[model samples]
Every structure is written in C-alpha cells, then in structure tokens.
Target: MMINSDNLCMSCMKDIGTEKQCPYCGFHADSKQIEPYLPIRTVLGNRYLVGKLLEYNGDGATYMGLDLSTRESVNIREFFPENIAQRDPKTLGVFVMPEKETIYNECLQSFTEMWRKLMRLSGLSALIKVRDILEGNGTCYAITENIDGITLREYLLRNNVGYISWEKARPLLMPVLSTLGTLHASGIIHRGISPSTLVVAPDGKIRITGFSISPVRSARSELKCQLYNGYAAFEQYGFEGRQGTWTDIYGFGAVLYRTLIGTDPIDATERVTNDRLMVPGKFAEQLPAYVINGLVNALQIMPEDRTRTVEELRAELSASPSAVAGTGVEYEPVVPVTVKKPVAQRIVDEEDEEDYTYNKREAAKKRHNRSSAVIAVCAIIIVLAIAFLVLWQTGVIKIDNDTTTTAAAETVEVPNFVGKPYSEIVDNTYNTKNFTFEKNEVYNSTVEEGYVISQSVDVNKKVPVGTTIRLEVSKGKESIVFPTGGIIGTKYEDAQKYLTRLGFKVEKSIKLNLDNEIPDTVQGFSLEEGVSYEKGTTVFLFVWSEPETTAPEEEPTSEDETTLDDIVDDTIDKIINFGRGN
Candidate 1:
C-alpha cells in the first residue's frame, strides 16, 4: 500500500500507508489540493476547507475558507514574506549591513502601541477587534473577521458614481468620520485615509482598513512614518515633529472633499487659498448649499479655521431641513380678516385723527385700482400685438392692391405609368426634352410594386411651370451569398492583409509567445484553421506561444561577478560569513 503526496496523516506527519482510512484519527487522508500554498487539504490544525483567494496586500494574502468544526465560512489571511530578509530585522541587518535595526524596532513598537490604544477606544469595538494571533513557520499572523464589502475605490469606478449626492453619500461618509473622531479622541492618528483604505459594505456601512502609518502617543516626540502625500497635512509637508488632532482632521477633510467632488481637494488647494473654490452647485445642483459650505470650511488650509470636531458637522447635518419629514408637525396657514368697529368707539377714535386718516385710506385704494387697470390694458394690448404678428409671419392673411391672390399657379399632373423599369424612363419618355427625372423609392400595394408610385407635383395647370418630374422606381428583391476562403498560418500582420484581400474585416488577432519548438507564426485561428467570411464580416485569429519563450532564463552574469569585491569590502569594512549568520 503506497501513500500518495496528498494522503498524509496529520498526527503521524506521514503518508497514510494503505488502509480504509487513517489509522491514527479515523480521518480520510485522501483530500484534494487546496491552494498553491497549501498543497494538501488536511492539516494539523482543525481542517479549514480552502476557498477562493480574496485579496493580497503588503500585510498578507486573504482567502475565504470554511472551518470544518464550526461549518462556517471564515476569512483567513496568511502572511508570508516573499523574501525573509526583507521582513526580519535581524536578517535585514545582516544582509544589508548599513541598515539600522533600532529604527525598525522603534517604528514597529509605535505601530503596536497605536493599535492597542485604538482598540481601547469607546465605540470602536465593533469597528475593529483583534481575533487571534497564530505563530507559523518563523512568522506571526493575525487573523481577523472578514469585512464583507467592496473597497471605496471599486464602488466609485463601477457605478461611475462619485461623492456628488449628499443623500447617497452621507451614509458612506458618516461612519468613516465617526471612526476618525474616535481615533483622534483616543490620541491616535490614522495618517492614511485614501479611497483604497475605505470599504463600503452592501448595507451602506463604511470601515477604514489599512493601518500602516498610524501614529500613537509617544514619550519622545519624533515623526517616524512616511507621509501619505495624497492625504498628508501641511504640517506633515513641513516635517514638523509634533502632530495632533489637527493632522487627522486634515486627512478626514481631504477624504470627505474627495468623496463629494470626484478629485482631491488639494488639486483645488490653490483655488481655495485664493478664494476661488468652485461652487458645488455648478457640479451637482441638488446638493444643499449649507452642506457645501460646511465641506469647504472643513477643508480650510489653516487647521484652526476648519471644523475642530466631527460632532459639529453631524449636528449641522441633523439640523438641516432635508433631514426632517413626517415627524407629526402640522403646518397652519394664517388668514387676515377685517372687523367693524362700534359707532361710539369709531367716533372717539376718529376725533383723535379723523380727516387725515380718511384721506390717506382713500388715496391708497385709488392708487391700487389705477395700477390694476393700467396692467389689465397693457396685457390686452400685448396679447393683440402678438396675435397680429403670428398671423402676419405665417402668411395666414395677406392684403394686396385691392386684390387677393390665393397662390393659384401652373402645375403638372403625375403620369400613371405602372409597369415601367427604371432604365426605360431615362432613355425614352422623360429624356429628349427640357425635363429631368429624379429617382426615388416608395412602397406600393395597389400599383404593380416595381413601377412609379406617385409624383410630388400635381397633374396639370398653367404658365412658367416647366420643372423636372421626380420618379420612383424599384429593383426586385434579390439576395447574394458570400464565399468562404482558406485558412493559412502566417504572421498576424500578413494574415490581416490576406483576410482584407478576401473581403473580410480582420476583427481581432491575439498574439501569444512561442518557444523554439513551435514556429513563431499564427499556429492557428479561432475558426477552422483557415476559413473565409462574408464580404463585410470580420475574422478573428488566436496565436499561441512555444515553451522556449514562456520559461524564464537564468542570468548570464552570476551574483559574485556582478558585485565588485572592493565595493563590498569598502561598505562592510569586514568579511562576514553569510552561512554562519543564521
């Protein structure tokens, strides 16, 4: 009983030598290959049914997998360094002797401290939670719950949607702002907030992901991480040692500005500084004025002028009239009414002011009436003028020297010739005279179909009416079949010319590299080696590469020859044994 490569027992760490099942744990050893990394499905840890590879980044490669014990789908991120020396500080220092390990350690410690501070912050528990840490072959891996959503970058591209509509964008942006606020309050700064780092879920929830350059509270202040140019603050550009809440505020404003306007705010930074920021109404008119104003204020170059807290923005949004609807508030209309005064009271009031008040009321009423009358007369006159102009321009009415002309002029009646071919009319009847024939096409049912249908001019009338008579003729419906051609293996450029000569449009040709074994020609096309197409139809071809071109070639110069012994000695100032370092 020989055991195959895939049928290995976990406990014994050996191939299961021919038994009905694994003798160790009664588990079937013969499972399929999972992935490139894990060749065998069954492993020492609770067997995770390997699924599709989700994504890969500097942190790790994430895969969708199912836990056998729990029977639930889980995301597993496997972090493997492409080159161990790149990731391990100890090895990096040995390989690249000029590099400092203390600097690397300090950066890592800063990031770790920031992560702990952020995790302790309130309201961020659900946003990010450390699940577990697993130690693998010489490296550490952190496994977290898979965030089910599309990256903000993808969502923007797929929908051709941008941060234009506040109604559509508010949900996606509020959460990110809330998260940034929490981080700021906890004295942690997420120095990066680009579109790629923001993830928008199907439920409209947003989460900030990548935390590489995140900064935390430090004892000895010194800026360490590289500044993200796209979202970096002015202070970052100046290389200031101190970064506080305002630094994160700048990044948040940048992200918000980018989401609303398709481009980054800094692109218009000059315009903003020069007081020439384009009005949001010009791009998306439906966006509320106040919202645009708030965004512009937040993106102010001077950090002090910008909104200091996310709570202020949230309050402004909540207070907007657009946010309220159907909240049990009823609107009432106010009506004005006049009440008659009692005669005794009127007499007493009039005695104090009488004649002057009476005269003023009369003048006001008269002025109102006169204005109404003037407006009515003007409107009537304008209406009449417009009616007369319309009638005159359209020639609906015309007056002439005490006489009216009804445009009765000379015309010619159409001849009833039903069964005439197109050539006969041009050669015989309408030929030898001052008249010409204009050919046209028309569908006829009553008339014999292939002859003249009708004419544009009338049958017959009088004087100065010598005009060319237009004719309608038809060709009997006929169909022609296109010929098929031969297929030949040739270069792509030559194949196109050959197909064109055969009256076929070369639609597409895919070229594939070939090895020395196969000829560097179109091995074949998608069609039957060589096939002809209709006169105007296109032909598609596919070319494949040979093994020689597909394989990678070894370098002609070896590493020892490429490196100068003198330069190596000068850099290191000593000879170190690479084999003994590990």
Candidate 2:
C-alpha cells in the first residue's frame, strides 16, 4: 500500500518515486526486461499522467496514473502483447507486423468488447468499479477507480491458518455466486475467476477485477489463456473444449480447495488422467460431507461432469446440514450427513418458483447433534452416582429392611457407534435392560452405505445396564421411483409435478416420434413410463413434435379425438412441449 501525493507505484497502486523500479512497491517504472514499458510520468492522451508501471499481464501491463483532465488518481491497463505487435517509442503508437496484423486486430476487438460488455453491468455490486476507457499510447487503456485492496490470494496467505472453516467461507462466497448468476443471465462468461482476480476492498466487499487482461482466443483454436496453474480449468488449456458456466465453476472450486486445504490443488489438466487432487474432506474431515462432495464434483475435468452453474455449486455447498441452518457454522452430525442434489445435469435452466415435491425432502435433513462430549461426561457421572445409591439401598453399604447384604456392579460406558459397521457394532453396543438399539437407514453420500452415519447417544457415557440408542445408518445416495400412475394424457406440467414428488429432476424433449394430427398427451418417457433412477437423475419426458403451420389441413379424424377441441388440444400440447429441450 504505497501511496505518495507526488508519485505512485503502478504495480501495487502505491506511492513511490520515479525510478527504473519502484523502491517502495517494486513496480518497474522502466520495465525493459521482458518488454519495454513506458517511463515514469509518461502522459497518455495528453490528459492522463502515467506514474509507474504496475505489473505485466497476458494482454498488457497495468499502471498507476493520474487523470489530468479531472485531477483524479486512476489505475490504467495497457494492451501490449509482444508476440503480436510492437510499440513505437518515438510515436507512442502500436504497430503490428503485416503477417500478424489480423490476429492483432481481432484480439484488440475482443479486448474492447470485453469492457463494453462489462459496462452493461454497471449496477452489479460485486464487479470492481471502473472509471473509463481510452485509446492512446500505441494501445488501449482501461482506467478504473483506484482501489487499495488486498487480493484474495494475498489475504489467504496472510490470514488463513489453514482451512478457513465453512463458517467463514460461505458468507464470503455467497455474494460471488449471486454475482456470477447475474453475469450468466447477462450471457457473459467471466472465463477468469481465481483467487488472484478476487479482491477484498477497503469497504469489506469482495470485487473481481483484471477483466481487461482476459485472454483473447485466436482462429486456430489456440487459447492464449491467463494461466494460474491450479486455478485454471482443463477446458482453458485448448480451443477444442467447450467454455461456459462450467469452466468458471471449476475455477471457483479450485479457489475453495486452496482456501480449505491451505495448499494448491493439482491443475485440471493433470487430474483428467490422474485425479490425484485430494478431496476437500480429506483435509477437513469434520467439514459437512456435502462440501467435500461438491468440491470434488465441481473440479471434474469434463465440462459435462461438473456442476453446470454457480447456483448449483452454491447449492452443493449449502447442501450440508450445517449450511442450511444458514448460521454460518458447521452443524454437528446429529442428523443425516448427506443431502440429496440433482445429479449433475440441470432440469430447470433458471430460477423457477414452480413447486416440486422432490425439493421438499431437502428441508428434512437438518437436526442438531444430540451427543457432544460434555453430555457424555455428565452422563457417566450420574450413572456412577446412581450405582452407589443402589448398593446402599440393597444393604451392600448399609443394613436394609431384611438386613441382607447384596452387591452389584452392573454399568458400562456407551461404545461409540458412529463410523462403525452397523452390523458389527449393533449387538455389542446395545444394553439388555433399559437400553435398546434402533437401526435407521439413510442416504448419505459421504459415509459408506451400511455404515453408521450418526448415533443418538454420545460414546463413553455410562447408561444403566441398558439404554435404548438409535443409530442412523448410511443408505448411500438416494434413489427415486418414477410413479406409473396417471402420467399418460396428463398435462406436461402435471407430469413434471408428479415425477418431481417421486424425487427426480424432470425434463421434456420434443418427441422425434410424432403422429400426424398432433399430440395432446405425453407419449412416453425414456425409461419405463414408471421406473426408478438414482435421486437427482434427470427423467426425460417425451411429447409429440408440433405439426407444420396451418391446422393440419384436415384433422386426423381419429376416434378418440373426433371433436375439433381435441384436435386443438393435441396441437397445443405439441407446440408447448416442442419449446422444451430434449
């Protein structure tokens, strides 16, 4: 944070002297090593004073500057890729070699369009505030409001002990998702969202910057991507890969991985074959299992394999029992650990308020942990005290009504039932007298199916000779049974509702197989009209494709659809279902 009223360091947005390299921030005022940079105090457009060379980037170098027109401090980005063009020191104008002129112009257009698109999102709060754009000094310049903030990377290195608990990480990331969602809705792909691009402003709001330096793709499928080893997704490595929301999803996941693990995750390219990157749970075992599961799924190298949107990734993070509480703390494991999510595909493209019985089950997975260590300790103390009283009452310590001497030592500490094979521990941990064991099977993504996910009572606690304890065993991931009832001839929406209640994501694809007259009913589904699929699986619903324009010339005159309205209904159904994706 070097700032001087007279001069400033461009790289750090700090105030330093006019020298070859900044003495205070180490910014190169005359960066001639990799490429020649503008000297200190160089003026752009005759109205902006360049103070110091900030830092070099893939597309250009950013610098600290002053707007002589308005007398305001600003940060400026200069487009100068040495591979494509050269800056004429005498004229301060960019000149491209004839052979490379085409690529240079196209890339320059992409760089300019990137900012114009950002300009459309002026109201978005999570975006770093910008001031203006200028064309001069042999390259374009993107000047933004001077921000003295710390990059998320710097903040992590300085503040993180290791993994910032979910308690602290969720709130920090939620706003980012909401912002990306807005960007997606705007049809803009941020292709850049790593720890380095995210900054925490002085106002405590996290803003994403470095938009001007986004890589410009060439016609040859060559991607000159801004590489941040662990943070860049696999698709970014080449032009053949599909780049979209999923690309950013991987970057966001990698950032979380670094935050949670206190180590850099392996690059997506390496994981395509090896997949040796450690899962989030391995580093923070106590983290709600969904967080681990989400990170793993998001980092999938295959674009189709990753969660498709920021919303989905956010949901996966919030899927944990702790996140639903929205208390910003990881809840104890008193309830089932795994939360059901729509597998990996999106049935609903956008946020729809439509009702689905399938989503309701999501609210039932949260409950407080009933067996903490303190309660276990107290239970032991009470049990031991009760035993002594029983001995006295039975005349072991004192004479009883019949003066008979009897002694009994019948008490044992409750054995830990969590994480053990339910079958192996059930008979041994149960008490014969007052206590009993109740077995419950629940779908848990983290714990192995048939293993114990949680126990009703704490371990190491003495409960009389027997106390009833219930164990929730992992049933693995959830499955859904598509109801076979009344789906035929039902409105598509109605079928969507019915199947959703059965715990499946419902999708409609135009039926390639259609009848001539029109189709008023759902012909069939991809699988059995009624069958089971893993929960979160997308159930494809098929409907007849719409007929060509004009009323089919003459109705099919089919027996059931003998009337005119029947013909209309079928055509309408086709028209509606035709709009849905396959």
Candidate 3:
C-alpha cells in the first residue's frame, strides 16, 4: 500500500515515500518552497516549472513559472497548498488553517479582476490567464508579463547607474508620471509605490507590479498588514488607514526623490509636522531648480499642497526654465585684472658693490650729455603727440566697435498662418526682409491639407532678424491602404507585422469554424475588402479555431474510426485516475 507523506509533487501529485527528493524533478522534500524555491525545468502549461513545497500564512503554496507566450517573457504563479489541504482536510487544517486561506484567496481573486478591468480600460493589453484546474489539481495559476530590466530598488542599489545624469532621469520619470495619472484617475490608490515594485524594462518602459499586498475596499482586514515599511504613507500607519490619491502622490514623489538625489523622502508623519523639507538641489548640486521645485510639490505633506494630478506635475516640469534650457548651471563672472596685483618685488643694492672710481670730470661730462639728450627727446615727443591727437580727432586712426547697438533692426512678427498654404507661406509670407520659413509635417484634425498646423513661436512674438520660423504643415487626416501582401496560408505573426508597418495596429481574435483548405490562417478581417481608415486605427484579425481541425467532416473508414474511438477512451481513463491508487 502507498503511504501518503506531507511532501507531494505539484505536477503528478505523487509521493516519493521516505525519500528526501522528488523522483521526477529532484525538488528537495524538506525545504520550505515559498521564498527561494529552485526553479527546475519546463512544464506542459507553456511554463518554465519551478518545483518545490509551498507554505501558507493566509494564501496557499505558490509555484513560480515563466510564461513563454507573450512578446516578452512573463512570470506565472500557481497555488498548490489548496490541493494538499483538500486531500486530507481533517489533519491539514490543524497545521495550516483554512479560514484565513479562503479569505486571502478571495482577496487575491478580487484584486486580479480589478487589475484586469483597469488595464483594459486604460487601453493596455489584458494579462494572459492560464487554466490550472484542467491539470487535475486545485492549484490556480496566473501569468504576468515579465519586465526585462531591473527593479527600481536594484537600480538604486547599483548607485543609480542610469539616473546619475538628469538627462537620463527625465525620460524615466515621464512614464512613471503617466502611469500614476492613470492609476489615480481610476480611484484605486497604490498605497505602496517604491523602487522594488517599479520595474524598468529594457526599452526604458517602467511597469508597476506586485499588487499581492495591495489594499482594496473589499478587503479591509488585509489593509493593516499591507503597509510597506519604507514606502507606506503616514496615514496608512495610523489606526484609521487613510488612503487616497495623495497617498500615491506621496509615493511618486518619494520615488522621484530617490532617483534624482539617491535618497528617499522623509517619513510622511515627520514631514507633516516639520515645516522645512530637504530639496533635491541640496543633495545633487547639478539638479536644476525647476526639477527640484517639482519634486518638492509632489512630496508635500498635505495632499492639497502637492500637485493635484500627474498631468499638472508634467506641465510644471515642462514649463520650467530648466526643462527648455536643459539643467540649470549658474555662471560666475571673472574678476577684473586691475584689482589683482603681484606681490611686492625685492630690490637689490647693485650701487654698493660697484668699484670705487668716482671721477668728478667724468660725472660732469655724463650730466651734460644726459641733459642734451633729454632736450632733444622732449622736442621729438611734443611733435609726435601733436600729430597723434590731430589724427585721432580727424578719425584717421578710427576704432571699429564690433558690439551691437540697442537700436539694431528688429525682427518681423509672425502672423497667424494656420490656414495658409505651405508653398504660399514659404514663398511670400515668410520670405520678407527679416524672416525665413521652415516646413515640417504633422497630423492635425482641424487644419486643412498643406496648411500650417502650428508654429514653433507663437503669433506676434518678435524674433531676431534672419530667424527661421519652423512651421508644421498639416498631413490632412492620416490614411492607410490595407495590404493584400501575404500568401493565403501565411502565419498570423508575419501577417500582423506586414499590416502594422503600413500604419495599422493589429488586434488578434480566434474564431471557431470548419475549413479544410484554409486550416488556420488569416481567415479574413472585420473591415470591408476595400476600405481605408485613418492611420493608427486598430485592425482586428481572426485566426481559425480548434474546432475546425478537431471536428473534421471527411467521414473516416470503419477501421480508422474504431481506432480513434479506442484512443479517446484510453485518454479519458488515464485522466480520471491519473493520481489515484491502482
């Protein structure tokens, strides 16, 4: 008889009786699996399997797996303790309580659903769901798209490799701000926003993850334990947990501060009482004033004192002088040469060392010669000074001043040229004495074809003479003609790329139907055969479903049909008693 042990393999549910390791995957039988389970190999669920035992405080044992389906690899999680507890419900509940587990499971399910709805509403791709029950276990599995880069915490620990320069931090902060805006608008507060949860992708995209401990209105009891130590707001620690958009605002500010200055924000409670908060410039002198001010507003103790929304923060950052002029570096003028003098030079007594040969006759002769020379030099200098003055006054020795005068010619004002033709403006309007025109193409909803959609400088703004006014000419509404490029039997991914290059976003959907010749190809599209849409419009594509192949129409021969039925019966028999005693 097979004796059941506490260690059960999640995959086949087999007991390696008295053995310290799994006979199938070699997973250590005695090790606790949740924290540092060694990932073993790939499994049938399109997953990279990590085999180990899982423990539960509330939620059940989780098996970690890597999903290979998406453009980027994703981390998949599976709960195994639920199955083990169900098998021996009487004894298992004594050790691993079931009441709290059930509550935690329900909370996880609700949070997952909420996340799915929010992602969909925000126009982000829905996370892929993996079927767990079909694997003949109570284990539930979920797949989340994996980020290619390091976590924000890891990034900071690396001495902020990418964030040391402000130029690098600007692009990094944009997405963080954008995501916060989306989360805040949905009325779901991310009470915990820290470096560990924010993952930076290889493409410079920042994705916020790890919502396991996140609080929802449905799970009030779990909120108390959900407080992240360094990241949680002060209101979260109080007896009455106060969570709002401001909670996330404070977190976002903390992340920005840590990224810019290599330091975290002060505790919320401490900041609330303290009048003065440290700014970014103090820590990193290279930081610009506008950026420092923006961070300060975001980290303000009071919600009302902080930026109302991420968009407002973005606008403030955009309008700052530092934003347009780049990081602000203060300039110090050079001191004048007249005010600085060399140290006093030491004098030598050369006369005292000279030979004692003082002759009165020679001295008298030298004096007479010196007087005659001085009289002659004075006469010559007087004539030269008179001539120089005459020449300077007459402008003969004129000095050419290169400095520009205040009354220099001014630039012509740019007129409202939105409705004017590109060629007309290029040839006539901007071809005036002091101005020139440069053309650029852009998509505009209101502006007509070939007309100026916008300009770099506003209308009536004065610019220096010979300045080139940059103009954005309307491309009229962007349009794309559908392609009939791929062969009838080409794969979906290749076909999708072909359409995407022509300025169309592809949407994939599977349809169940029967077709022998076409098998599983781009069956067709929702749009008409010959219709054009504005560029960037989503094009939904459908692939043939499994039913088309599973239930084929060509009648089988007697012997063949019988063989197929026999195989089906065997498969069903194996599934029914896969893990049961023989």
Q: Using TM-score, give the best candidate's number.
A: 2
Q: Rate the local accuracy (lDDT) of all candidates.
A: 0.49, 0.66, 0.54
lDDT of 2 by residue, 107-167 (tens): 7877777676666776778887566778765468777777788888788888738557677
Clashes of 1: 13
- lDDT of model 3 at residue 329? 25
TM-score, candidate 2, is: 0.52
Shift in Å, residue 491, candidate 2: 99
Give one digit per residue, the lDDT tens place, for model 1 in 243-317: 556556657666766676676554222433453434344443555544554554455555544445666555544
Q: What would the TM-scores of all predictions be?
A: 0.40, 0.52, 0.41
- lDDT for model 2 comes to 0.66
Alpha carbon deviation, residue 485, candidate 3 (Å): 81
Model 1: residue 223 alpha-carbon error in angstroms:
11
Q: Could you tell me the lDDT of residue 439 within candidate 3?
A: 84
Could you give candidate 3's per-residue lDDT for residues 76-159 as a string of tens digits?
A: 444323221343333212222455566545655554564554445444321122332212233344444444567777776877
Error of 3 at 469 (Å): 70
